[model samples]
Target: MKPASKSLWKKSVSGRVMVSILVSATLLGTTAACATKSGTDDAAVGVTDDVIRLGLLSDLTGPFKAPAEQQNLGIQLYWDQKNADGGACGRQVELVTRDHGYDPQRAIALAGELNDSVLAYQISVGSPTSMAIRAELEENEIMAIAMSWSPDLGESPSLVVPGTYFGAEMVDALDYLIEEGRVAAGDKVGHIYFQGDFGEPALEGLTYAGEQNDIAVEAVQIDPSITDLTAQVAELRKKGVSAIFLNAAPPQLASVAGLSEAQGLDVPIVASMGGYAPQLLDTNIAATLEERVLVVGSVTAYGADEPAAVAVRDLYAKSGSKVPPSQMVVLGYAISAVMDAAMEKACADSELSRDSLWKVFHGDFQIDTQGATVPLDYSTPGVSPSSQVIVLRPDKSVPGGLEVVEKDYAGPTVAKFLDR
Candidate 1:
């Protein structure tokens, strides 16, 4: 496969380089037949008489390592149970994991190495890394469920996004603040964000919603490498904004929250799901987070009464894991359930080829995660699978150190944003 075009990558918006993919008769033709054959003469590459292999691209040693490791555990937990229960389509599930350490170039190389050997990538961890490898997956006609979400990924049918993108999440979060009377029309809202894929989309959402609500949006773009957010928080404080929105990593969040409290910014702070971690509750800023920060995400929180949440919790206990609870684990298990359903569809069709599996998502196949998230459908290109979001606040007593403030929220701004 060709290396992603450097010129295109340079021009890509907010680090999101997208392929203008058109999935049609030609895409589903001989390209799929060219896949490596195995198992009863019709199985695709990565499928054997006794195993079906899926790839894992994660950031095990980088900034997001904590949550990434938990997600990997969740992925493994799902397969372990499936393999124990006689597996999917009568074959045990196998994972081919590669740790990219949050590096984009490393992710591209790792994805190339696994392109021809796995049925699909079960998880691709970070926004930048996922963006980096997307073109290669399209070139190889492989499918992947990217844990990162960007508007760019929506354009490709080959990459499945489990829920709405960061933009939608941010939009709903702002609306949640408005509905809860934290902010109102004509108020000024401050936003602190990273410079690339993850933060840009969220900033866009906040800007759009601000316009609709007649609120002035004050945005500060920060480099991810910067851990001290005292200046940013002080700047926003000087602006006298009513609320603050954040899109960044956990450490950055710690800095912002701590500094905001020390400076008496005294405003409600909301963060994108990426901006938090369960471990943050053990830090000096723990009380501040619980008192002020709200996190927006699509999946149910850990220890929720939802059935899938309970199942994953049981699995974690059975495995004797010392890792603290995380919502990423539930997401890992949910995406695996989606992958299993697609493969099962292909098996029932009597043609377990790459094309058959890919077609399931493009057809009427719907993914239900039993309350892990809203039901998902991937048939429409450039569209989010679900707009529903769950808002949570930090609570040390909670199993995940977070509890839901609102569930299944689809505020008008977000609903309209997704509609467009």
Candidate 2:
């Protein structure tokens, strides 16, 4: 079961009948069906005669590395496990990857590389790159499973993201927190976010949720270039806020987490998906978080209840991830599942085109809101899941999500108002 709060994706190769051809990516993006192209090994565009190829462009060493590396590993692992066992449709799946350094320009070039190799593509980690390559994606009609929550990107036909916009989910999370008394009524809310379209949606989600819920919310923009967070934290504190939401990358996220702990503010330090510290799972740092500063997370947290997730941790240990296992690591496993399913669909339909692949990426699917109580089925068109999110706080039994919370609060579907 994959966790909600966005995801990265992948699949495997091998165990398939050899097509006797090794297609080159340069001629792979031709839209029309290649009933017969040429170059038995390097088929021209639209020419499908075996050998399924996949391309992944992720932030290998940038802000998104933590998650992207996991995604890449998961994809590699899936291919390794599958090819050894047999790839989708008995046809070997080939995966090619490039490091984007989380730069948009690099992402654009990488996108071309991806299009040249496979009919479908999965771009993970960071929205800057996603935004940079958005237009090109549409022009090329590449099938994608990116992990950003920007609503604007959703409008494009090529995108196939898990669930829907994080904006709505954030609203749901805020409402759940307030109604549960996690926050008091009329309390001031402050947000510290990175500037750009990447951070815009989360801020919008917060902005919308607070407005609709009657909470006073303020925005505090932080430049990635800035090294410290004292000024921002102090300013938000001055606003009389009882809680603060952080929308930033690793650098700023670490700064915020460290500063908040050092400041010793009583205010809750709520975090966006990006703000949660994936590297702090094994450190004493988790113990330092303000008691109420829980970050929002999907059900795949390091402490989730599922056995599969447990298996993922074991795999992490076996594979040797430098950073102790965390929710982000498990998230890589989830992305693999999604990609595997997409690959299967691509092979089966004989339509290795991106448009065809998107048609079945999630297998007529829906996620249970990242493993929520009630299954969110996105199998049908226009229908998707609305899984629950959990609060990531220190001293809590679980790091984040409802994996360790009382059963009732584990997810949005698991109501806390049963008596009512």
**Which candidate leads the pack in TM-score?**
1
Model 2, 1-420: lDDT tens digits are 112222122210111222211111101111111332233333323324556666677777876677666566655654555555555545556776778897888888888766776756644456667767777766665666666655555544455554434555466557667866766657778877777754666676677667666787788887878868889877876777777777676566666666766776666666665666545534555555544556664434556665545555555666665654456555555555555555444545554455445445434443322332223344332222333455445444553322334322332322221111
* Candidate 2 residue runs with Cα over 4 Å from true position: 1-50, 261-264, 281-285, 320-324, 346-355, 361-364, 367-387, 394-420
**TM-scores for all candidates?**
0.89, 0.75
lDDT of 2: 0.55
RMSD of 1: 7.3
| The best candidate in terms of lDDT | 1
Q: Write the per-residue lDDT of candidate 1 for residues 1-420, one digit (tens) a residue.
A: 022234332322232311122212111111111122344554378877778889999988988788888888878877788777767777778999999998999999998889878988999987778888877776666788888767677666567888878888888888889999999998999998988768888888889889888999999999988999888888999999999999988888899889988998888989888788988999998999999999888787887877778888888889998766689888887787777777766666655667667666656555667777656666455577777788889899989888888878988888777766
Alpha-carbon lDDT of model 1: 0.78
